[model samples]
Target: MSNDFFSTSNRIKSTPFTSRNNMAGVKKYSVYNNTLIPTVFRSLKSDYFHLIKHVQIWDVCCQKVIEVRGNNALSLMKYLFCRDFSKIVSGKSYYAPIVNFEGGLLNDPVVFCVEKDHFLISLSDSDLFNWVSAINHTKEFYADVNETDILTIAIQGPKSEKLISKIFGEEIKFLKYFNFKKFFFNKESLIISKTGFSKQSGYEILLTNPNNGILLWDLIMEKGKEFNIKVGCPNMIERVENNLLSYGNEMTNKDTPYDCGLGKFCNLETEYEYIGKSSLLKQKQVGFEKDIFKIHFNYEFDDQPIFFNNLPVFKKGIEIGKATSIVWSPKYSKYIGFLIASKKIMNNLNDYYILDKGKFEVSEIL
Candidate 1:
């Protein structure tokens, strides 16, 4: 890779863990949420194996939060996302899918209940921050909406509990999945949640104090050495195998939840009004013409495979739909990826093929 591939500039901000990531000799970088995120370290394959076996620390500060507080905070939450927030308890989190008025998928973010009337929309790579701010200003709701400086550090893998217990004590293991609690580290209050990007059991610590970023990273590395912990990023192959969808790749503003295989997350029975409630109800009734599918490439390639977004999906020379975010899966021994194609083609998987340099079969629907 050339230096020009991802040159450093003022426009592309660096996270608090940038220096630590450089010390780890990060191999590659990817822009996420306008921040430089470590993509690879030693090697993708080696990192994947280590992550599954041991544990690794990930600097995911790029998972920015859109903080909403004040009297109408809950109102704003109900107005934006499709998930029913009626049952959301304090100190817990829920995966909420934000959508446009037309029911197009805007962004899928995890909503954290910090206080009785306070919520944090920990977002993926999208400009939903601006959208939220605009909505707050226009609505004049009794709520304050602004971006918070809560940096997230992820300790992921099987031995994640072992590593976290050393610092936070064994009681840290008691936190249930998708639940978060405030704890003291160096007498400074911080939030740790049993949530992560990978399917593996882990936790993401939200550091309110920016100064503790390097200290926390160094402590984890120092305490984690006995566990053979390594610095790594989210593995592409592992995420694909788990059917984890990536924003700006698997689906975008042009796509709806139905098209992206996220219909189950949408709450249609709720009587409370949401941004796209009516549109989503209509979409649910009419049904989707296309949906997401997993593709498997037959040929082999040593280098990383490149997928052109919206690559034509063909069936007996007739175009049905398009593919996006195709990645080679070493675990499955094939190039597997996510794509959106006609429901007809997805149902009759024996016929459809992804048109790339060569044809690849639509392996599975997940």
Candidate 2:
């Protein structure tokens, strides 16, 4: 393994569970929203295997939340993203992809309707606070947008339900996927959501009291011993193999929701006046040059593939697109990743190459 630097200061804040992560002997970390988030606890292959079979806890406090409340909060939400929020059901968490005026993605967050005028936007690794605050500053909408202090933790895997039920009771196990409800744990109330960053069955607990952080962690850890729960974070190998796109990696400000294979989440036919509706409509009418793909390599890489940025992909020695994320999947025993290929070779992915040598086996995800 290679050594990379991760320095924390007053600017790069630490989560409430940072000390516990250290005690767990965390191996690596990735900075999200100017906060330290554990990337690996034990090892990549081991963590991935464990996450698929057993349960694991994650320090996801880095998922900053922005609260938009008031009468016109619905109008402001309509102007934010292309997702149709007019028919949002109660007790449901929505996956909203926020975009700028140019139809380019700004940030994709999970939104919860706290009330009719009150909504909490759980963000994903980007500074979306300033954008929302600035837009609502015009006073066109009578809404208040502020950054909230919400510390979040995730319990993920196949056995997550059993582990969470030990403390929160069996009623929480029935909360529908992408749904949330308030549950009591001792005296403190935890906003438990049946949502997580992994493909496994899991839940994210939001702790309002920072003082309750370690106590809650210890309780879960103690009770979870029977289920073999271990400290873990978002594993790259599992995410890539499952085609779970990470913000700032799989998609960025340079691409739109459509370009990143998130078009179905958008509603262009609806008459909702969103920020980039026109741009998205025009792009859809004209067509995009690239889209994301699920891919694999013909050659077996000896070491784990750790990519910092998108690697240039080529076709017959000509640059076609880039491989945004890559990892050596131990289960697949090959390099599986996501590729954004140009329209010319997007349909014919067999001719794609990464190092000007090997070919790619691309298939449609879902």
Candidate 3:
């Protein structure tokens, strides 16, 4: 709610999404670069959910961009990923999931193919930077990797295309999904990619110069006057319907890429040596467990209590699993959520009862 939160600079603030340690009350995860606004779950769910359905500008600089540049950039990346980046041409962006040695999902970051030798990895959280740095320490690859807290702004919603088209001209409309094009504003170079969190068309603009962050934001707001633009973040309800995976919610390093339904992004055919290629291949060949499912509530309850599944799900008094991301869809008027459980429980979806404030039978499958 504070405009000061959006001010350009590195300053971390604790919110509901962040947790504090008992003795010192220290926050577990600090929003890096400090300039980005930290919108909490409850605030986003109640106040801004409907507002974000319209167009809005968000200071996502905290999302951060890590630059991997040098002669050996591609070769270095090959050693870290299962995907083959050798054919990844310039001016393209790809949604690739970073996996560990056991093919577990580390982070799902967007890889921007800036040029044949230069690549930019846009991270959702700070973990990606540490992972990249850790890999570099082993001297397993030869590339210069530097982490930069570059400013990133997401202009999302239905009218986003119009607002952007006006600022950068009609040329932006030609840029396909996951494709980026360099443009100049006040002679300052910026990268605009046709990508965002909403199901509606939008763009994520990367400003190399932090000084231009406010300038770019102001210009967009001015031009967006007719579009009814309201500054907001990506809503969970919208993302859930689209089946978009939230970083910490859907899957984590504990879950393998195959378990999270991201196996397609793992390109095992690539000849390059990667971190956990052999382990991943072995898991795949031996047949790993799969628990991809959608859980629905049979009846509605109070908004607050029904928002999250606080009780443990059990079959015959045996704990199986718990719910992850839950959202009440305004569009569907149904409470839907994504849950991870054993393959046995997942296969018998009908028997599973999602206990909210009250018991709601599993209404549908994803």
The candidate maximizing lDDT is: 1
Better of 2 and 3 by lDDT: 2
- How many collisions between residues are there in candidate 1? 0
Which ranges of candidate 2 are over 4 A from the true structure? 1-5, 300-309, 352-366
**lDDT per residue, candidate 1, 1-366, as tens digits?**
314457777878788888788888888899988888898898877788888899999999989988899999988888888898877799999888899999898899989999869998898889798788877778777588889899999999999999999999999889999999999887799889999989878999998887787888899999999999989888876787788898898888888888888888888888799888999888778887678877776554555553334566676777766666566666777666777766765676665464753445555545
What's the TM-score of each model vs. the native? 0.94, 0.93, 0.86
Can you rank all candidates by TM-score, best first?
1, 2, 3
* Angstrom error at residue 131, model 3: 2.3
TM-score of 2: 0.93
| Error in Å for residue 39 of model 2 | 0.8
Residue-level lDDT tens digits of model 3 in 265-352: 8787787778778888888797767666666665644545435633455555566666667766665667777766667666665665
Ranking by lDDT: 1, 2, 3
In model 2, state the lDDT of residue 109.
95
